[model samples]
Target: MDCLAGSARAVPRWRNVAGASRTGKPVIVPGLIVANVAVFVLTVVTAGSLNRNFASPWFAEGALVPALVANGEYWRIVTSGFLHVGPLHLAFNMFALWIIGREVETVLGRARFVAVYGVSLLGGAAAVMLLSNPLGPTAGASGAVFGLMGALFVLLRRLKLPAGQVIGVIALNVVISFTIPQISWQGHLGGLVFGAAVTAALVYPGAVAQNRRRVQIVAISGLALLGLLLIGAGAAFL
Candidate 1:
């Protein structure tokens, strides 16, 4: 699956859109970008080519292959998200992550943002395992980036900000996913669905302000469990 689907325009600053003070500076977003870049560099060094990192042993070990996952190499679901096919793929995905991830991190705080990102990555892998060719290897952060995009849309709607641009961007990406060969629409759609659902749980915890945190905990836990169940079921299919 191609990691760099396209450039998804960044959302306007939350403070500008929602008139709320900034909650936190972005810590996790930068860290994630660095991690992805570092992994890409290592893949290039090992493979001795910028565009052919797939030839690297790192790719062999990390890229998600459903048959291997079924054989119990379960860590591919996480590592594959960090691997990329080429420099261009890595660049585009990191750019999208910087643009979209920082805003989501600022709004959700570190712990919650990490939770959503981790689960969304797994959700994407689960979809791939369940639907894509069992022997084909897939890698990249597109799925997680798509997840962040989905989260950003939910956040904008929650703040009552104009979401026309976000909706258009998402629609455009969905179109690209279908038109472009080698793109994993299954992973993209899975991440989007799970990310939006997880963010909705966080932002829409019902009445009773004092119990909002408690409600968020329950909701996020439930979603995480659901993601795990999906992953396990996908493995069974593999």
Candidate 2:
């Protein structure tokens, strides 16, 4: 099966729509993996005994985590997605993305994939801000990965695909989350929920494509609102 097949298989089924080379092929997702790997090399090399936040460039942040720290940077919300605390961390997440992202992006198209990813990242960030101690910082692409998985099954359901395996895949990750320390459970769960919502809205049949658009707009708006609220709340604590 192709990239689109993997995503659609995660839960429900959605047919493929042909596109240009970028969205039609499998290169973009792996390219992202390479980019992330390159960044991690820099992070590990820099994060010696002297600097605790050496890998700060990899984590994502905004008004909440970065805004609180004196030396913290603001663009972490996007940057953090590229950073991994250890080889294992990076490998696992990248692998998951490669397997899931390719198919989802292929099916959703690049622009929509980007949209789904961005919303999921924000959703992950929002969850961290709301639940975690404001003073503490959380980062990783697992949230984004989790988001993709959630999207797969939900998207399939909307298109009338089988959803039997989706729950199993999700539960496996959740088990890993509880068993793994320093893993961002908030981010994972948050991203998963956000991705599902977005995919569901996008693919959900409503008698008219316009209705689907309405569903997506409302869902995206809700996630954005929640992220902004977390930013505000984090600022308050600081």
lDDT, candidates in the order shown: 0.80, 0.68
* Error in Å for residue 180 of model 2: 2.3
- Candidate 1 collision pairs: none
Task: Give the Cα error of residue 141 in candidate 1, in Å.
Answer: 0.7
Q: lDDT by residue for model 1 over 1-238, one digit each (tens)?
A: 0111111122344322222234446788999999999999999999998889889999899998989988999899899999998988899889989988887776776777887798788778878888899898889998888898899888878766677888888999999989999888988888888888888887777846567778878877888788778878888876
- TM-score for every candidate vs. truth? 0.89, 0.78
Ten residues in sequence with the least summed lDDT for candidate 1: 1-10
Q: Which stretches of candidate 2 lie over 4 Å from their true place?
A: 1-22, 48-73, 205-207, 210-222
Q: How high is the lDDT of residue 62 in model 2?
A: 25
lDDT computed for candidate 2:
0.68
Candidate 2: residue 79 lDDT (0-100): 71
Best by lDDT: 1
Q: Which stretches of candidate 1 lie over 4 Å from their true place?
A: 1-23
